[model samples]
Target: MAATLPQDIKLHTKSRTLELIYSDQEQFELTAEYLRVHSPSAEVRGHGIGNGVLQTGKQLVGIKGLEPAGNYALKIIFDDGHDSGLYTWEYLYDLCQEQENYWNRYLKALADAGETRHGNMIAKG
Candidate 1:
């Protein structure tokens, strides 16, 4: 059975982002770019783990629309033409709680892979 979601849901909008709060006291400030890159949709995360595509050049992306998916999730449409991630309440809470650690790890992974998130570096011939 699925876990019960929080009773109260709140959303706050910033200049280019949205913050979601749950009744369980968990919160997430989802930047447009972060949401776009980390979308749970097959297009972004792929069919399974380790199949996620690296998304770059979306530092300024923002949310263009939001739709409710019953009581368990939300559908987010981004300005960059991505709109398939169904963000569950629990999953979103986890993302908020783990954003800092996840972001740091992502940065480290990019470095280890000799990659730049901005896509400005060029390979030498």
Candidate 2:
């Protein structure tokens, strides 16, 4: 079974990042660009499997605000004016736990697909 989110969740926003503190004392500091491009919304993640979109031009983005969505999720607002994507507790936890691996995989995928995260040039597969 999935673990339930802690009752106390605190978010500390910096100039270009967000620090998430869980009740268990686990902490994760994520950049706004990472969070923005990796959003779980349909626009980014798509509605079903194998429909993900490539998010580009988010290398220097920052969080504009954080809004609570009941007790299960948070609506993260970005400095680029994106305010969708409700990040559930489980998803957030997974993101934190798998941060390093996910980031590496993302970078590799970008290279393999010849797609740059900053939209510079398309790579040939």
Candidate 3:
């Protein structure tokens, strides 16, 4: 079977979510934080296997824009100055399908590392 591509894409800046609509009436809403932490870029994914870096403090990340990469993928420009990862159609679809599982795993990893999604915040009085 061929890979499923979205029929329409909506970037909701206010909500910081990317909505993918399919012809079958299916839709998936992915947050910027989720996409940022799961980026396929070498910076996030690492140079090779088992060296991936954990993205922290991305709870407030937002999508700046989306650019199509040829006919196979999307180049997502994030508000945090990250623009390296190319989210292929297949990968995006997989993310949509396994969002819950992936999110749970990410949360678990963060907990294991004693990290917080809020990253390092400096309180001002």
Q: List per-candidate RMSD values in Å.
A: 6.1, 5.8, 3.2
Candidate with maximal lDDT: 3
What TM-score does each of the candidates earn?
Answer: 0.75, 0.80, 0.92
Candidate 3 segments exceeding 4 Å error: 1-3, 120-125
Q: What digit string (tens of lDDT, one per residue) describes model 3 on residues 1-125?
A: 24478989999998989999976668999998999999989999999899999999988888889999999999999988899999999999999999999999999999999998995533221
Q: For residue 48, what is the lDDT in candidate 1? A: 82
Clashes of 1: 0
> Which run of 10 residues does model 1 get worst, by summed lDDT?
1-10
Please, what are the lDDT tens digits per residue for candidate 2 over residues 1-125? 13646445444455577776664567678777678878999999898999998777677666767888997788998767778899988887788889988888778877787877674422221
lDDT of 3: 0.90
Kindly provide the TM-score of model 2 when superposed on the true structure, using C-alpha atoms.
Answer: 0.80
lDDT of 1 by residue, 1-125 (tens): 14335444444334556776553555556676666667888997778879887776666666777888997798887766788889987777677778888777767776777766664423221
User: What pairs collide in candidate 2?
Assistant: 114-123
Give me the displacement of residue 69 in model 1, in angstroms.
1.2
Q: How does candidate 3 fare on TM-score?
A: 0.92
**In model 1, what are the clashing residue pairs, if there are any?**
none
